[model samples]
Target chain A: MAERALEIRSESHTYPIYIAAGLRHQTADILKGLGKSTFSAVLIVTDETVGPLYAEEVAASFADEQPLYICTLAAGEQSKSMETYYELMTFALNCHLDRNSVIVALGGGVVGDAAGFAAATYMRGIDYVQMPTTLLAHDSSVGGKTGINHPLGKNLIGAFHPPAAVIYDTETLYTLPEKEWRSGLAEVIKHGWIQDPELLKVIKDQWLDLSAVPVDVLNDTIRQSIQVKAEIVQLDEREAGIRAFLNFGHTLGHAIEAEAGYGTLTHGEAVAIGMDFAMKLSGKVLGSSLDSEAYNEEMIRLGYDLTIPASCEPETLLAHMKRDKKAAEQKVRFVLLQEAGVPLVRPVEDDTILDLLKEEMTI
Target chain B: MAERALEIRSESHTYPIYIAAGLRHQTADILKGLGKSTFSAVLIVTDETVGPLYAEEVAASFADEQPLYICTLAAGEQSKSMETYYELMTFALNCHLDRNSVIVALGGGVVGDAAGFAAATYMRGIDYVQMPTTLLAHDSSVGGKTGINHPLGKNLIGAFHPPAAVIYDTETLYTLPEKEWRSGLAEVIKHGWIQDPELLKVIKDQWLDLSAVPVDVLNDTIRQSIQVKAEIVQLDEREAGIRAFLNFGHTLGHAIEAEAGYGTLTHGEAVAIGMDFAMKLSGKVLGSSLDSEAYNEEMIRLGYDLTIPASCEPETLLAHMKRDKKAAEQKVRFVLLQEAGVPLVRPVEDDTILDLLKEEMTI
Candidate 1:
């Protein structure tokens, strides 16, 4: 397969993202080409599930170079916590990894976030590379937003430490479970909805059964999604402006994930539902002319439950949204679509949100 | 006393350093003048000792505009640990501090480093102001280096998050204990040794008893020391080149501090001994023509112990030095001075270091 490369340019740093199948073996050569020869050691941070499968292969690539240490955490959102981050730092210290060392994050978003945060802070910032094994990481891996979750919220503590490179090997996705595919596809769907409506049309026209999608189609979709994300991030690395559009569905998405308890639902599952709610709210509040019926049918066909759980109270979710990092002066800020490919971030009133939640519950 | 301001320009950021005797009352105005009107809340991170003494006054400055919360840690080097850092993050979360919130580090280096690190990681970086309460902070408060210490070494986990402004009120130093004065003077002397010999000569000529030094002289000396540090940091924000010069005495100094245990001996005291050892080593190894006898007499006059403590073993200190973040490939790197203003950073072999330890033990 031919390799495709994209450059993400930000004010502080610019790095490339290489997408291809079966490129894991090129990790060391690619890193050396990027001017990383002075590192004394490499710490590979992965999850237990991914560790036993691919870590050795990646480590083998660096066999002749500096010593490589693998630090594995349990696989899931629960692993993205302060406790896990602290343990990873301690592991790096025990390995005697210095400022000259490099950290290789070798799993999905959980491992990437935890490890990237550890690298971001270990010795006051070091270099890290992202070798994302999951399709969802196609979005998370590019931007420099590395962090661990607080009990009160998701990604409340983090840093903008961009990865040295993102080496995405689609071959690894062959082993992904069907449910994981549905979860990852939600983000791809989100990328299409926010910036590239044509991509959404293509996804709808092709790949009706995500579980059995063609490899070429998957590769093209993932690449397109990353390009949208990279363009937004490059323009606003700190999220001071246009980057807020990327959170079109994440405000309520994160709340649902937090209220549902982390890992109870995959990130995509929550985001899918959040997107449904946001579309309805935008229609009522902003008079957005989105084709809600068509969007809902597509989401249901893609294996999503668009209903808010019975256990989750409207008031509780509203409180969570207001506490979101985007909130200002106790007002719940939201990214509402004026139309497809045109998102607007503004503060929504509590009474209006309550009304929307009541309406969502009836559905 | 008149106010003095200096601008530190780096590739990543530009901030001001305001030095005066009574600027504490103007904290809020200074921040507003710097265009910080959007903050939803202000978090004051201080130590227990300084919290009781000055936190209320500082808190009162921000009373009308935004909500204020104070999180205080114990006053010492031991507080610069992961446990404290985690607690600060949790506190910020509980207070609902978001991306727009500002963190005011209202104490010396310990509070500044710990709080600055928290702000750096909280929401992937936020704005923070430095309010230096100790003269020793003249060095730490200027640089963008912020972090917590690991059990393995000091500042092993951190980031280079620069402050938005540094408000130094010399009035705070008047209440400092005599021991704290001696502790802060070591860094002042170090600044003189590394870049400004004229400053060193002035210190030696004017101040015999550090405890009784005139307030005007104290303020002038601190301003001069900060200028030296600011000039160097402006040239190298990430510690890539000229920044290593600032670590002239820190390699061995940090090892001694680690071996002695944090807070057992003051930081300046450790640096003083480290400076003495580096000078002697430079004379023997680099063939430098430094007058060691005259320097030692000056240090003794300033109430510093020029000899390595009998309790600290040479092999142990060497082991600690090898673990420093600056160490590469098990060889300890030291910042040695060929003369008063010419510094060199290079690796010293294990055998040579052991032999130097033996020589120093005999003294």
Candidate 2:
């Protein structure tokens, strides 16, 4: 019951983002506070791995609740597909969930995206809570970019559907492999780099070994990252203007992900490469000292694989980027870094993009 | 183009409602304003009946600007199904429509509901316009209650997605069969009965002989009905409160439609019977002088079969109504009329409903 809750206030709703070590142990008290006097049915959407660990604990929390349906899918980005989305919707309908029913999403980014999209479309939207068990989910669950991937591109069909609440239990991260932890940290690093230079400095100074990082520090970092995302989402719920800034590392990142095929590489790894390219382009265009060669060295030292794979050529990535929904006409837009706390979206010329790719390949 | 334009102003949007004798002549100009310069694809959704006449017209309107994709479904309530919705989504995707792509609903209420729901979900929603060709669409086009039907009930799966604009070309009514005209007028009659007693009197007087009623008067009546619907929808976007008033005849009417099989009888015809039964119950419970007997006589004179079909037994109709989305706690709630101008949702006891049905059958 280590409890210092992070509060999120949106235009339409206000809820707490509870981040604690082993918060799953207090599920009953949290459900009571959320005003579940009589739970008729609950749907738990999870992945192949996390379901075994926490599904029973959550179901036990609501033992008196009749007919709790637990549905699990295969882990990874490939699961975020139209087929899975359709299956989940049919499951919800078969479960006879009224509007009062709550769907709990428990896994990493893929599970959150697929499950949340299901909740958004099933019966024209319903209440959903994010029980994020992976570090990547700490970002995806909070901001509510929920949707499945289209065959043409990653996240081509989706909606901005905020969850009813987010429960990030830090204890679940203890079982995560080192590579998974690194994969998650890229996003945390991006958040810090984009919004808070102070947080970035703190991570740079304190984070050396992934295993030994204090739970409180990790919780604070996740909460701060979520707060930054939540504030941006509140200002623009539907990504009309400033909200597009959240695509800081996503333009080239998505193309790389789509080219490599989903599940070939973790999302954060692709994003790590995209962020490096964007920073290089940002330095070229904006001449920011923040994007200097030292910044690249720092990123490499922080255990980020910042190279675009030889299998996915820069031209292929460019072709995929053109197919993205954000592209206006034939020109693709990238959200590049102006400085540590400032980002800008601009259309880069094809030759310049090619030159950057060529130069970065030698490194 | 015989110009008649009025603006509909709501909190989220302000658009014009246009009515003209031959407004289809202005389709090109109307679409030019609505079509995005970025999207090169246009999807026109129409019914089998209307497709032959107007699909080419709409296609020609957008000929210079974008590629037109015409999709026609069976011209009835049966078209409002998950299969139809999925097909429409696939059509849009296959057409290579991005976010900027536009959908034009070109038939009646069925087309509007089906197309609007497709737009609401396709690519997580896209822009759409309502080019309503029938009088009943005055209600459906303005309210944004777009949905596909579930096996359990009508509008069981839906989203409240407002269209970009509504273009009502009154001249299309010249091609409508007298039966089709009568079918649409049922909704017009319901709108008048729920909110405007004066409009009801005008219809009753002018519509004594359906052949004698001028098209201008009919158009005005439908437009007024649309205003009433739009005003209520503005107050309650979703059917959370005031909007439920619009479902006055829908509960029992839906049951009758479903029981009879969707294509067997027109929507308005089913609603006309529902109205007769509702008015009779209202007179009994609310002590209103509705003249339910006279109402039945007038409907019969107007060539509407106001009596419930013998095959539609009371218990079966009761079962359908109980399964209706509007029903709560296993009670079939009826929106009863205290007077022509006032409607209230009341829970009618099972015995009371059975008595009213028996009495109405005798009458």
Candidate with maximal TM-score: 1
- Model 1 spans with C-alpha error above 4 angstroms: A1-4, A259-264, A310-316, A325-331, B1-4, B260-264, B313-316, B323-331, B349-363
Q: Among all windows of ten consecutive residues in candidate 1 chain A, which has the lowest summed lDDT? A: A321-330
Residues A1-363 of candidate 1: C-alpha lDDT, one tens digit per residue: 234478888667778788887778878877877765657899999998999999999888776668789998998888898888888988998887877889999999999999999999988888899999988888899899899988776788899899888999888987888778878888888888888998898789888778777778877888889989988888888898999888877888888888887678888888998998898889888999899999899988887888887778999998888755443466877889988888888788889989999888986
Alpha carbon lDDT at B342, candidate 2: 90
Across B205-254, the per-residue lDDT of candidate 2 in tens digits comes to 78776644677886777778887787778888756687777877777788
lDDT to native, each model? 0.85, 0.77
What C-alpha RMSD separates each model from the true structure?
2.7, 3.0
User: What is the per-residue lDDT of model 2 for residues A1-363, given as tens digits with 9 covering 90 to 100?
Assistant: 435467666544666688988777776556556654544568999988999998888777765646788999988767887677767777877788876677888888888888888777666667788888988788888766788776655566665566777888888998898778877877887777678777777677877777568998888888888878878877876676878887878888877877887667778888888888888888887786674566567677777777787788877777777764443455677888788878878888877787888888776
lDDT of 2 at A348: 82
In order, what DockQ does each candidate have? 0.80, 0.38
Q: Candidate 2: misplaced stretches above 4 Å?
A: A1-15, A25-40, A63-67, A325-329, B1-12, B31-41, B151-153, B208-213, B324-329
Error of 1 at A349 (Å): 3.8
Model 2: reference contacts kept, as a fraction: 0.24
